[model samples]
Target: MRDPAQDPDESGFGFPAPLWRAVARRRPLGLDVRWRSPLRGPWLTSVLGLVLLVVLPVVTVTGLLSYSAYGPQFDQAYPGDVGFLRLPDFDWPTDPPWLYRLNQGLHVGLGLVVIPVVLAKLWSVIPKLFQWPPARSLAQVLERISLLMLVGGLLFEIVTGVLNIQYDYVFGFSFYTAHYYGAWVFMAGFLVHVPLKLATMVRSLRGTSLREVMRTGRDQTRPETGPSHGLIPTDPDPPTLSRRGALGLVGGGSLLVLVLTAGQTVGGVSRYAAVLMPRGRQPAGTFPVNKTAEAAGISREAVESWRLTLTGGAVEVSLTREQLLALPQHTATLPIACVEGWSTTQTWTGVRLRDLARLAGVTEPSSARVESIQESGLFRAATLQGNQVDHADSMLALRVNGGDLPLDHGYPARIMVPAIPGVHCTKWVGTIDFEAG
Candidate 1:
């Protein structure tokens, strides 16, 4: 039997308040006891980690936009007939189909990185809750409310994020859409959380080094004094750094494992690749085509005499569509992601964007512009700045999923940009001018 007088938390994992108090004051066990950055070094690293969090959605959005905006392959693989009821206007692909497997993999991999980095930063600061200093009463209440909001929002995001990763559905909705929408919520909470954290960091860094204070042991008995001391309350006796360092190392390592392994386990690289083109099958044609092109009001002849222009700030001259195709045709199998949140893997045969840049008298492929003809009848342009077009993974795609140009997709030629949004992968064969920008 446990002593009822001694245990309060009752979990028996650690000593209770009475025991700690006895240790602190050399008083009886019936009593209670307690103890506890210049925010710069640790806080700087913490903020960098936060910045990485912001980049997560940016990366996902870029990749999705690259594939979805155009492609006959995308239409055939995930038909629009299965559009979501809630977002009826948009096509939603949530089945664990091959393309979805890989798309979800990237989504979950990026998310796994978010969990640990956030938790480590949180752990470093939670102890200071007790060390919280006296503020204006109203200010303190508001600060407390803000913290609660941050915590609540973080919990909601993390829970939903983890569940989605595990292929678990919470509400009666598709995890993909829910996860994307939840990301905005998480981002809102994150934006709110940053200012509060900045305030905390300012308070933390306003003082002398925490190491110096702890070394002098001056913080063990009294309230901190001077701007060097700032707002952290002095504990009667605080815990040591040795344990904290070990715990931080453990937490950081766990996060790293999650980050590196995610691309393999969750992203579905092998399966997506296999399904989009399949194995041991001769490809059917050079471009993605089907009946969908007619339905979309696109014509079959639009592909003939297709030209890709290359001109930009980096180059003194531009090349026309004929000059580009005459250069050399390079090909590879790459994945495409749509803004509507679906993806497909296909074999793309084309002249490498780099090769075309070189033939166009471009000594530097870094500064280039590729334009896409959108369904809205407006051209969408993206700069291949600073070795972007020259990148080995970026190409002018003429074939998809082991087949010829299907009319709905850019028939004679298209662009394929790997590891970015699908929007960057323009469908129609057009002029890509190489110039410095």
Candidate 2:
């Protein structure tokens, strides 16, 4: 409906003017401007937004870096539903072996740590969601739409990510695909939201000081006087909690979340404190198993018949477990890091991938597809870029820490690349096929 106060003779043509008037005249209970929440104000929202501004970019950039680490250019990343949306082509680096470890750790850890701030920020500005007129202008309408994406996309990403971390998949969708797409959706809204709100956040925070907020009590708690921005209430009730208390509640919750979840990323003794993180619950000694052979549907009978097949050009060699062990063995210390935020580094003794490539007469191979015996799941196979294939530290490990690979740890053979994501390591290796790009 056209606001007669602003356009006395204008008409809201082609719109449901009467229906909108009905909604505006008798607003929904939640949308009522008289909402009596003393803590809901621009100041609270800006503070939370300020925190998010400082951290959300880190989470987002690392999330992208985490995805990029999978080598989408080589078609080795998890199967995201749409291929066109893939990141720009580039050769992922192979040095600083801990690259993926650090990227993934920050991605998962900071994503979880920022939840309380996100929730508090949403709570602070929820009143804006129920504006009576809904959209005052075309620009406002578009902003509201972006806001919808921002909130919905964020919640979807967070819930799916957390559920995946817990190994819970009640949603019945592939977490990798959903999270990958949802991140882009969230980023779209986030990019639009930041510039729109940056000025407001700065304006709201201009005169507010940390010292002033801490000293204020319920008696002093009040909405900042000025443009309400739909957050300030027309009829605020007596404060049930002081501003400092509210800030502390949100800040403390974030700290607690950081403590519990950061341990998974930090690993070692602190891992014991990560009760909620599955990978951290048990220490990953020399052999840390993310998925056991049994869980992966690998049975004793399966590995008993397991044979490593190497194929490239005119060479095709099938080797039994003994043959692989008989080939020269090399040991390298590397970390096995998973996307679920747990990692362990240990000595791995195995056939160098480059050596295995030469055994197949596949020198200068453009790529290598390592397949596993596991009957199902995405990890059953992974393709490695030439860089990953040629990395001297990359290998097909037959033993770990001077012992045979544990059945749960890929018994016969498993691929281990210094910086590759654990899932791409291709555990329970059954075949290695070299490709010419």
Candidate 3:
């Protein structure tokens, strides 16, 4: 091996550093790779990396879509403060127990699968000593910056995600919340990765074969004269075992641990989940009963007359308080899975959104968007499609768990969307507007 300390003359590029030789020598001693199959090692590692980077994100996005549509039903059914339901904030798994359990299991299981795959990919690729030709000088800078960003983002997400599963230090921000937002950063980094990988692949295809390169060497030595132009270097160091055998041990062990950990986590949480499970009974009798009836200080009749108005974009409908109350109502027991990873189920009673849509002469669900008025007036909007409105589980809930809606829980009336996030199901709903598109 060339000693980096001996200042060698610069190659044509003025930077023929001996860094690679130094790195090769430092490769861990006795790290058994001999039984590994050369062909299977890189292939399996690449496939696993692709699955972790691509498939997992798609699943997470689908779940996020569901949460955005129907979260309130779950919240009312299993109030967080009551017990285990309260543990995972809207990010990790604290509210409804069942949802939390499912999300956590998926999160941790995916993490375990990703860790080794990421490690293997890094091992297999780093020694290639090849860089894609920059599209422009700025593109080269961006490429380097993106590489660093990918590493940083991956480390942060994986570490934070793992810690969240152990229920270890929360690091201040909510676990699931951080995970949710971190996804965007990770996604951006991922976008950059694709082009970089494509460049590497194109270069590889144009490069020499690994088999010929290996045949020319002492299994591990870098020949003073390198392989043909088409081949990239296979093993820059003492030919340790091929990566194929090591993968079997690593993959098998990882899968086993994932199964055991998943079982244990679910088993521990099932009892708590049972407590938050829905009662299955539906709402009956006077819907949206006045909260003042339970407390005499508030005017029952006047409060009952409160109306929710819709005005925005086009078509303003001002229904009298009575007309609003008289609209047809329906109820259902569904689960709310918060971003925090906790979930609960409850019986939600409210007017069927489709019934309200029909009364308002609205033929399509996509036309209307709902908003709510809170003390802070932070009204969030959600596009309510016709199918989502007509869904058997969807409703404009005015009651929770067979009782009057609590003030903290969007009393009077709130949209209860199924499989949607809590935020989109506006509380203390006061307005709806139909848009052109």
Residues 90-176, candidate 3: write the lDDT tens digits.
422222424443554455455555576666665554432232221123343455577666666676777776676445765887655
| Alpha carbon lDDT at 1, candidate 1 | 28
What's each prediction's TM-score?
Answer: 0.41, 0.88, 0.48
Candidate 1, residue 404: lDDT: 68
Question: Best by TM-score, which number?
Answer: 2
Candidate 2 wrong stretches, greater than 4 Å:
1-23, 29-34, 81-84, 215-220, 283-287
Worst 10 residues of 3 by lDDT: 3-12
Clash pairs for candidate 2: none
lDDT digits (tens) for residues 368-393 of candidate 2: 98889888986788888899989988
For candidate 2, report its TM-score: 0.88
Using lDDT as the measure, name the better of candidate 2 and candidate 3. 2
lDDT of 1 by residue, 66-143 (tens): 234222223421223333321212232312223433554455455455566556556545543443222223344455
Q: Of the pair 1 and 2, which is ahead by TM-score?
A: 2
